[model samples]
Target: MSSDPRIRLSGVEHTFEGRSGRVQALDRIDLTIEPGEFVSVVGASGCGKTTLLRLIAGFVHASTGTVEVDGECGVVFQRPSLYPWLSVAGNVEFGLKMRRVPRKERRETARRYLDLVGLGEFADAAPYELSGGMQQRCQIARVLATEPPTVLMDEPFGALDALTRENLQAELRRIAKERTVLFVTHSVEEAVLLSTRVLVMSPRPGKIVLDLPIETDPAQDLDTLRTSPAVLAATEKVRDHVQRRTPLRQA
Candidate 1:
């Protein structure tokens, strides 16, 4: 692996203006994410967690400072974003198709990723035909099919039922082993469970309040890891920074 960071944000800040007035969303965020790390951001609602992801993904530009991503990014939003008219396999192949990849190569790539996400059986199924969880899986497959170096996710499982969310969490953790991921979620436990590092942001005009490392064995099972002392302690620390609005720290 290269020594350089996969993602970096330097003195980053963002603001949004509307009919009402201007609202500052982020403030002085300096972060560095190395390759092959799974990082999660957790904060109170409206704390600009999503904005941070958007900045890195280049969906929105930072009002000041610079945001750098070493390679292309694949973003997965809270809701599944598959085209209704396309079959699951087609949705996965869409990115390759847009790039004009040869038909045979793209189909093979689509099938590979669909199977990786456990959606191979539903390759011919329409988006509406699958349940919410399955639809999300298909969306994830589509993103992975593009083979981006970095993945930015914003509350991808937030709307799912508790059981489904937990299952997907495990699946994501497994799938993220070799991928660089920046995940944003409101759940502290989820952050602790999934991330190699957990970042807590202060309320609106968000700043990094705490940057904590999670030292867990990736090979360990999620259920067992959940109750482990290390995970519990990390969860409490992240929750404290988020709930108490701890002092600012550069991430």
Candidate 2:
């Protein structure tokens, strides 16, 4: 495997031109994400978290500086953008089919990923038939089916219920174990739990203000890890950065 960073941004800035005027989304951002790292970004609303993900995903161009990704990357957005008309299996296979993989090969690959996401039994079901969490799992399975080197997620689980969100977070950790991930979320705990490192972005014209590493062991049970001192401290540090609050000093 190559040792190069899977994603790199150098002095990157992005601005949106609107009827009112130009609005800057990102300002002079420099970031490097190495291969096989799970990095989560958090910030207040309109901090350009989504914009940064889009720039790396190539959905938009940076106004200045450079955005470089080592290879093809898959994206999972806030909504599960599945084809309602297609069966779960077909939705997963869609990307592979576009690449012209043989029908049987793509079908097998789709089934394999669906099984990975715990949706193997729902292969024939329409996307609408599944619950919200299942739909998101299908969306993830679709991305994994393509075998991309990097995955970019923009608040992918933000809409789900509390329990479902946590469940999906665990599933995501397993599913993305070996892949390079750039995840954006508003949940500080979620970021701390799932990321190898968490980055806090300043408000609009966003700049990364804090880059905090998570030292909790992934092997521990979720409950144990969640309550661990390391996890709590890391979460607090990220929360403080996002809220722009200083830690209390003790005598």
How many collisions per candidate? 0, 0
Best by lDDT: 1
**What is the C-alpha lDDT profile of model 1 across 148-190, one tens digit per residue?**
9899999999999999899899889888777899999999999
- Whole-model lDDT values for every prediction: 0.92, 0.91
Clashing pairs in 1: none
Lowest-sum lDDT 10-residue window in model 1: 242-251
Which regions of candidate 2 are displaced past 4 Å?
245-251
Candidate 1 local distance difference test against the native = 0.92
List candidate 1 stretches off by more than 4 Å: none
Clashing pairs in 2: none
TM-score for each prediction?
0.97, 0.96
